[model samples]
Target: MNLNQLKLFYLAVKHQSLSHAAQELNITQPAVTKGIQRLQEYYEVPLVHKSGKNMELTRAGDNLFKIAKKIFELDKLADDCMAEFHNKGLKHIKMNASESFGAYYLPEFINRFNLKAPKVQVTLEVLSNRQVVENSINLKNDIGFVSFPVKDRKLNSIEIIKDEIVIILNPFHSLAKKKYLKASDLEGQMIIMHEQGSYFQKMIHDLLEANNVCVTMPITFSNNEAIKKAVEGGTGIAPISKKVAAKEIESGKLVALSLLSTPLYRTFYMIYHREKHISGPLKQFINLIQQ
Candidate 1:
């Protein structure tokens, strides 16, 4: 079977119209029709039929569509896997980061790195700060960006940056008008929370617990972005990293309030296995980060 023709057939079946498939594939409508016709000729069975203005798949076409979906998915997966193979003097760097750094900083940083070394490929995985620390200690990732300092003797931790955690609020929320928020000001207020066991979440809990302040937590999210969106939609207020709220704060889409006289902050650490080799591309990346 011709895979190109099969691709066209899959697209046609997916969109339920040859013309629509043609538009998606950036090919002419007649090309899509011919491609499907070739598939039918090869199988000696009709694959599609017209009813009014819509196209419907035959029994054989339905079966082929299911198989085609799996085929194309695997094909794309293989392409991605092979692209990551280390060869031709190109280096692949594995990075594991906390959600905030991964979402807010890494993309632009990686783009800049790409311009500096086009051949180096960096794969990033966003996880909880604890997971980031564990992966670095276990050598599961080459580098880890996490909020809390690492205490493990097997890993080397370098202080990267300090992130100030701020109280996030909807633009029109009652608290948004406050220049500074106190622990007592937030008592009994609805709040969004982070996932359990998160380092920053622990800090927030500690700060609140220390002041004997309690808030209603209606929902929890695993990442900073989701929590920000929930707060933007007026779900509730949350204490989050200023780095994560920079854009929203600047645009006035969200308000970031200071906590009374107490400043909440978390230090980000760059960690790696002590025994891991630092050379070539990895060394270059470390230099870039340090700079």
Candidate 2:
């Protein structure tokens, strides 16, 4: 059961010479013999016999040698894998983020990171703000981005960006020409809402309620893309991050109207578990994004 003795026996069987095995092991020939002797004693079998200046393995020794070959090969493979990781030859990063950051912001950072570390594989999942925080706290991901600050002892967060919530309307909508709009401007208008209970939905809801603005909520979508599409199709006006609709605004497919009475903004934060190990590739990615 002693690994050292098994190794000695394996090496002796491999070279068919105790002297050669000892030379490779950097030990005395007598030491190699004693090691093999201990193995044979423990197994209660004659593993090897001298035959005309060469060593031959018995049937039991042949079977043990096969298993030893596999064991040593696996050990070597494990060493090689660890060495590659230490050298940063192969790396993977898993991340979770809210839809706004994941869909609109993080792609640029990921592209830049890939240019720097082409070998590192990156995976990103889009979830709600609460889901991002929960995943980060549970160590389900290496990093996370959320729309709001997270206050958890198990997590470390940094405010990465501040995003403004803007009203997105169809370019042909009557209010699209207005430079800005007041809460009353949206009264009785069909409002495209995010999924119920979402942070974004709550933010828009609170803003409207605070100003006593009553708008008809006719449609709800779980993701920004769907909401934007609905707005472009003239389904209703939607309140969303300006950055999320930047392309549509630039293309004149959608017009963004600022809130004249109460401006709304949300902070995006990069979060990770305090106990998570920041590997070389992961640190590089964090630096690239933060920069």
Which of the numbered candidates is closest to the native, going by highest lDDT? 2
lDDT of 2 at 51: 92
lDDT tens per residue, model 2, 203-288 = 88888898898999978988889999999999999999999999999999999999988998978999987766677777898888
Please list all clashing residue pairs in model 1, or write none if there are none.
none
TM-score of each: 0.67, 0.69
Which digits, one per residue and each the tens of the lDDT, describe model 1 over residues 1-291? Answer: 999999999988777778888999899999998998999999999988989877788899889998997687556545534544546476788999988888887787788888899988799999888888877765577789887888898788998777788999999999888899888898998889889877777888888898998888778997778988999999899998888899999999899998876898878888987766664677888888777
Question: Looking at model 2, which ten-residue stretch has the lowest summed lDDT?
Answer: 76-85
What is candidate 2's local distance difference test score?
Answer: 0.87
Q: List residue ranges in candidate 2 displaced over 4 A.
A: 1-87
* Cα error of candidate 1 at position 188, Å: 1.3
Backbone clash total for model 2 is 0
lDDT on C-alpha atoms for all candidate structures: 0.84, 0.87
* Model 1 error, position 172 (Å): 1.5
Clashing pairs in 2: none
